[model samples]
Target: MAQHHKKIYPDVEIAMPTRPRASLGLENGDPSPIRWCHQASPSLSLIPSPSQTPIQTLNLNPRRCCCKCLCWTVGLLTLLLFIVGATAGIIYLVFQPKPLNFDMTLSARFNVRITTDNPNKKIGIYYEKGSRLSVWYKDTNLCQGTIPKFYQGRQNKTVLNVALTGRNRYGTTLLNALQEQQQTGRVPLDLNKNVPVSVKLGALKLRKVRILGTCMLIADSLTTNSLISIKASSCHFGLKL
Candidate 1:
């Protein structure tokens, strides 16, 4: 009976989908609002809000200032040392000082030929008073004398004659030794000179300084009655501060 239905048909009503009334700008008196929503894919519907990561900051420690200060201090000290060394070198090169040399020869009996030399090329010597020279024979001072005060110019050599007279207490002892050594042609004698002098610069005069020089002589003969000649000689001198 269901397959062979009659020709009578039943009537049915269906409603279509509508958009929201608020989207169409409709008033409350209009027809009822119908909301229509699109079907969303479950994999792509949700979206997260925009956000930013916090920025990192840096702070300086106190030790950084100490390191910087130390570096600057070392640099300044090095610069000062260089300057002082350069100044001292300059001063040394500008001034040239030298020592004096005394050379003597036996030209007469008791009259001695004395030669004094100023070795300094840029400085002159002003020989002051209280300067003396002596001759010795066998630990006995044979004769002693004084040199006149004079001004010795730069790089100069002067020759003078001096007479020495003294009482010989050990006359026989000296004569016996002279006779014994004269035959062997090896005689020893000592000469010492003490000089006080001042150096003269361009226009300035320096303080007085004592120079003690000694000469050891080996002679062929040295007799009280006869003259002697130098065979070998050695000299040494020093400056007293």
Candidate 2:
């Protein structure tokens, strides 16, 4: 029996499973010396680091990023405004909008002919409502009218006919004075206008703008029975800005 126990034994050594050792410096830490930018925190917290000196940190998440978002939005808006202003200035310089030209006649009422020359090749004008026109003589408004709504094309000339008719308290006095001036061959009158309009640039339509104008004219007569002719006229018209 002792001879049989010592006869045949196969397995002798056993190995217990163990975690493999880290190799090739993969698990130790980041080896490169370059450090990533650290975000600054508003919390009263302390974190240990190798370098004690306060490094310049980005305030990326300050105050939960609310103030940062607001500042970025404001900066973007300001930049957009500056770009728009520059583009507008360039457009103005290259294609200057010319002032309108006016011609007039009187037949108991004022008949005005206006000519507009738009310079922008891509812009169009749309005359809106709330338009007004007036004629004055010696601090008295003699007549008033309106500019009929219409659309004007780009880089084109447009003509308009406006009739101004009204009555004043000093009609008789004004008639006498007009007759006296007609006798002197110069009947002075001042013409004014305020017209609201919209502009179309490319695919965008702008807000209403006031087109203002003033005309100084010398006429031969103001009576319906007599022939009324404009002698000398000076007119100026522009956008009210």
lDDT of 1 by residue, 1-241 (tens): 9768867776666555576546653566566666667888688655545554455577877799899999999999999999999888887788755668654322223566889888888889888999888887768776777778999998999997877656665566666766797889997878888989899996789999988989998888765676778989899998874
lDDT of 2 by residue, 1-241 (tens): 8887886778877776576634334466857555456789778877768598578877666686888789999999999999999999999999997889654333247777878889899999999989999988868788889988888888989888888887665556667778888888888989888999999998899988998889898888776755568889898989976
TM-score of 1: 0.51
Model 1, C-alpha of 105: deviation from truth (Å): 26
Model 2 compared with the native: what TM-score? 0.52
RMSD of each: 24.5, 34.1
Q: Scored by CA lDDT, what does every candidate get?
A: 0.78, 0.82
Residue 199, candidate 2: C-alpha displacement in angstroms: 1.5
